[model samples]
Target: MTHATAPSPDAPLEASATIDGAEWWRSAVIYQIYPRSFADANGDGMGDLAGITSRLDALKQLGIDAIWLSPFFASPQKDAGYDVSDYCAVDPLFGTLEDFDTMADAAHARGIRVIVDLVPNNSSDQHEWFQEALAAAPGSPERARYIFRDGRGEHGEEAPNNWDSVFGGPAWTRTANADGSPDQWYLHLFDSSQPDFDWSNADVRRMFRDVLRFWLDRGVDGFRVDVAHGLVKADGLPDFTPPVGAGSMGGQAADEEPVTAPYWGQEGVHEIYREWNQVLAEYDGQRVLCAEAWVDPLEKMALWVRSDEMQQAFNFPYLETPWNGPALRTIIDKSLAAFSSVGAPSTWVLSNHDVVRHASRLALTAENPQGHGIGPETGDRPDRELGLRRARAASALMLALPGGAYIYQGEELGLPEAIDLPDEARQDPTWFRTSGERYGRDGCRVPIPWEADAPAYGFSETGASWLPQPEDWGPYARASQRGDADSTLELYSRALWLRSTHQLGLGAIEWHDAGDDSILWFSNGPITVVANTGVTDAVVPTPLRDATRILASSPHDEGALPADTTAWFLTP
Candidate 1:
């Protein structure tokens, strides 16, 4: 856990250096690909590995540095591949092991590094281990791999604890024995179909260790550790009492202490990552481990990325921050400072497969803005134009910051949540677990648009997308945006290009004096990024008002930055 003290923002980062030509991820612009919705090659109405391999060229052309792939491991698809049935094999729903190898080779050929999801916290109910655990007598070794315990009530009738599932309902589910009697209760922080592992067990630790080596040896570049902070529960399966009310994304309310959460950010989790760091160091590619921790107080989140643990952790607070100037600045400054405490680089993310797409969520000026668990209103349509404008601006501002960034699959196309899907078509476990009161994240999981008019919007050759695509998506299709200068896709491409060729991601960002609450202006070296989230047009501030205009989220003509616009400039 030892490293040199963090250098000042102006100094080059030691972690950003090349180790046998593997310094790409330090300031890399990584893209997240949700397999089932990215594209479908065999026309099974779902995206697969072969389809992903075929589209590597498009991603390469997108000017990104790497790809962070969600799970495609063997599974029952109960959690869409997160509930892994077999850690070493590919799920047929996606493709075979050969398909994964081909996809890896193709991605490398295009200079794009591959980082797959690692779900060490849980396994599908259908997995051989879980199946054996289900059939074995209580207190057997098979049951030890999972977190199985006898129920607490008389006659073992009730669940072991009162903890709630992240999806919904009780966290513990009872298992029946051959005698038709309730045997034991197993813990699943998410769905009952995905049983949580007992990290304290030696076997569980060894199994995940082997799984990590299996992927690392497969020529993949890294892993995005799913539920990275939830590996080890508190000493006892304690009742999680939030200081105030309940919450998700680490399940802490605004005023709740982050590190004290019962099921997350435990001290034991670091030992797991410290060992994982050794395994990553053995590989040649500077194979990284990125945590999907949602812990807050930024300093607590920093624990996961200390020199010996994970290389990076997602900056969820930044992703969830509102599009206000002072609010965003506070989160940004705190995030940078926190990560610096550990001598690690902070990773910025906008939207991912698990949340509502930022394009639409940022446009919500009404109730429940995070778009978590809320379905679309019966007769309301989100402000598509407004959301896209802000998303574009946010993208520029994110890329201009000093660290790595992640782009969800369709962010570049200005895609919003597919809110109009019929209730019957929804598939998130949270929806069913909550009895339809919670919509879950299916809205953000819709298949992406590639061709403007092709069948299923070019998601599948058979014109069948696993999740329905909206009709309005045609205008934002890749075909329509590829050469269009004003398209969000191209705007992202240009921003990434500037980011890659310059020292923007490695340098400090100093605040620019715009003197307006609605606008955020910041300078990185000689380049400046100004974002106006207000409702009125804004004049660029100060002596550089007439500086050379470069890239913009929306068009800037005659020296005026329109509302919800972001523009890049050269500080003359």
Candidate 2:
């Protein structure tokens, strides 16, 4: 059930005697960089590899251990670079391979590891393989790399089955036969422009393995596997309805925990990773693989990170879980127990490019779970005061947990979702395919503000934001909050610094007052964390009363914490 080699105290990358590099990911704080929205260079109004290289100083100052860059692979940009046409080349819009090397060089120079996004489940329809598949006749070798099937109807106009695209509409797109009649259908779980690859094909398997090597040789520290749970489909491609309450984030959430889906979690997927693990083992940088899976039940998610599989998996359930004290505590405990069973550390996350900014989503409950779905009226609004306050408290608690953490760009600045972007400015295909029913992820992808009053909030020297920025963004710009003691950015920087230097990520967590239900109290070695989720102020518990109050999410004098606050204490 568990096979990973246990980490030793003397392992590499250890910040001190407390944390080790052998399992650096266990305590590492990784920052997710959506290249397009991170920073702009070349006056193209688009963030590029060069821009990322230029900003390594900012990232180093943030106290993060690594950067997870979203895809910059050669692509049609139909799905904002997710539809990759070439696995080895960089998109011209984001600069060339040399720029990526410069970025990687700069990152490694500052002790920051670089992890690139890898989309192996699908490729752009314009890919050479797909183009050859199109030119070749039916049942040809060229078509074997993709999931192409014969249509069922008389005119062969009908899709192969009832599977629907995650974006909306039919998953199967009928392609014209050699005679110009719609005959063969290809599967695309996302936009039609992205054709799903057939993992069963030997060529597909060998090709991706080579892709991994191409980047590994380029000094990449690791990869964030896209659609990590989506390569293997069910046998026969039978039809089934997705249970209600399925997840809307990237991949489908289970109808229930430990979900059973024909499309996700096929046994073959693990074997693929086993092979990948072997590839990573050949590299020497303590290189790792992290899954962007939407799997459910913390235990189910752990399968992706088995001893010989990936090293980390996105904690979507924790991200989707509500802000209630009990719920948060339960998920955290469950995640710890699950990952521990596999000899891997659990990861904590609150926001990413695909989801709404937690600072704004914290105010949402089950009844109002719409994340960044803006309408003409009352849609682009959340109680900012309440949401931002809770988000701050949660961050303190999140960083103190006994494992790794991921920080979404702009989140450290308390940026809210750019919900009011006009329809024309929205870029996610989910918006166009769903006919606007789903506002898509553009709100969260808005370029981050770097200066309080500069043009384009200092994101672009040309004042040309690819996606328009809201006027309010100026207040949360990096320049405005950089050194403010109580600012979200400072809170995050201090939290990460403490998490690493104190060995908090290495020890076990002892719950202090979990039974109280309205509060979460726990201790990790010398670092202690407490959060008050109740309406009224919670008295500092007895054991912590004598401890040293090192920091707090909200402004407060020593020992006095207001409601909706999370505080850190150093136990003697």
Candidate 3:
């Protein structure tokens, strides 16, 4: 490993030696592990906390600074762990709280902090709070846990708002009283099985604080707050006006109503975040609190990361933008400018369990020309080389960013999307409700590919994985990548090692317009990253006058890269 020394001029001249509570996230690289897909310990073909504990060596070898485990809370799995039935206990399927304790202890011993996902906006219908709220009398303390209203008066015949659930259908679900009359309606912004909590209620807020305390008391490091912006909604029930050109974009329609604004990033939500921050601070800076805010406008995104709020908010633009040279450069420049304006630390991600995998999204071949396509035939096609090149290029750019970087599970192995699920086997409710237009996230949620020849690729030694393993995953398995020096796994390791050894974490980012539409050039002090997104080679302009030391390349070539390739250069 290369050793990097702090520059004399770059040294911080402060007198105090105490570490900042929020400093843990700055320049940290987080590896996201979807518990159910990472490893299976009980031979149930499903990953558990114990399974994750067994894999700490792999994470350490990858040079990741932290691990962000998706929700392992007790749930009905309605939204794949997003709907929490019990915030204080680990689900039986994942493992007991003891398993979590062991995992946390082991991770910390290796200098890796563990940040678990916390969903505050919604809870499973089976949760004690939600169950009691469903059976409580009007205006009772139990009823205050959620947004519940009586059938009489203004609440009758109309919903509190015109908002729709993210999964599809009405946001409010009406419940009948014992007298056979409509007693009340409850709000759920995601699924009927997951009801939204009322943040306006002081008691409701306290409950979540206790939940955070529960985890912190157990030695957990921090949390990644889920849907941080969706905690509060507009106070008044209002009608939603669809934006001009509804459904024009092949995605969800944008809501143009005023209620939609406050419903996402309301001013009231910050108070809740501040309260949580205060509680976390008492843990002596050992814990953290990051947010999963979906808003892209820099101003809106920065709201969750202001000094008094969350330590960091996930950068959605980097995750959703098209993998092109010019487009990616603009995103990086805009994000840097936005975060700098707020004087807050930022977080970046290219793939997560909820979205399509980056390799399948950015990779392209003659057989899968559109690049969004996936399946068994995708691996062996010679044209797929371009896809692998693009995947590596994107990784190089992500690691070179100034803030925290997140790598989703299977991304290091360059796993493609699982697109061959039969209709009978479809599991994701989001795609099922959308009538298959969305293709369900099942493609990205499939089992992780482990050994190349093991039955079920070693993801399971039993029947089959919860989601069927893609037949094409053999070539991209862990064993295959382990043997190939030019594999995507090696590329990710090289990029990660470079970031660790070069103190690239503390450097300032300077993006330069490379003049060509296919190329993007960015500099972190003496290091420069150039990515080629077009179908042809383009000259990359370097600001430095010396020959660039080729530190890492996606194609493993120090020479000029082909289209869809990315290269990192260090000053010798």
Write candidate 1's Cα lDDT for 1-572 as tens digits: 11112122222212223435335666788899999999899999999999999888788777787899899998888888889999999888998999999999989877789999999889999989999999898888999899998888788888877888888788899988788877889999999999999898998999888988898888989999999989898877777655554356474555556546778878899999999999889888578889998786788899998888888899988988888888898899999999988888878999998887889878877534232534666234568888888899888889999888999999999998888888988889988898887788899999999998899888898998878788788998898888677788878877776676566767788886688878898888778888998889988776656677667888766578889888788774
lDDT tens per residue, model 2, 1-572: 11112122123333546333447788778999999988888877999999898787878877788999999999999998999999999999899999999999999988999999999999999999999999887788999899999888886777888987888788989888678766688999989999999999999999999999999999999999998989999999988677666654333443454455677778889999999999989988688899988776678889999999999998887887777788888888899999999989999899988777888788755333323354344444677888899999988888888788899999888888776789898889888998888887888889999998887898888888889999887779988887677678878777777777786766679887645798888888888888998877867777777777777888765556678899888877
- Could you tell me the lDDT of residue 183 within candidate 3? 75
Candidate with more favorable, higher lDDT: 2 or 3 = 2
Q: Estimate each model's TM-score.
A: 0.94, 0.94, 0.88
RMSD of each: 6.0, 5.4, 5.7
Candidate 1 pairs with clashing backbones: 247-251
Clashes of each: 1, 2, 0
Total backbone clashes of candidate 2, pairs 3 or more residues apart or in separate chains:
2
For each candidate in the order shown, give its overall lDDT on alpha carbons.
0.83, 0.83, 0.74
Where's the lowest-lDDT run of ten residues in candidate 3? 245-254
Return whichever of 2 and 3 wins on TM-score. 2
Of candidate 1, the 10-residue stretch with the lowest lDDT total is 1-10
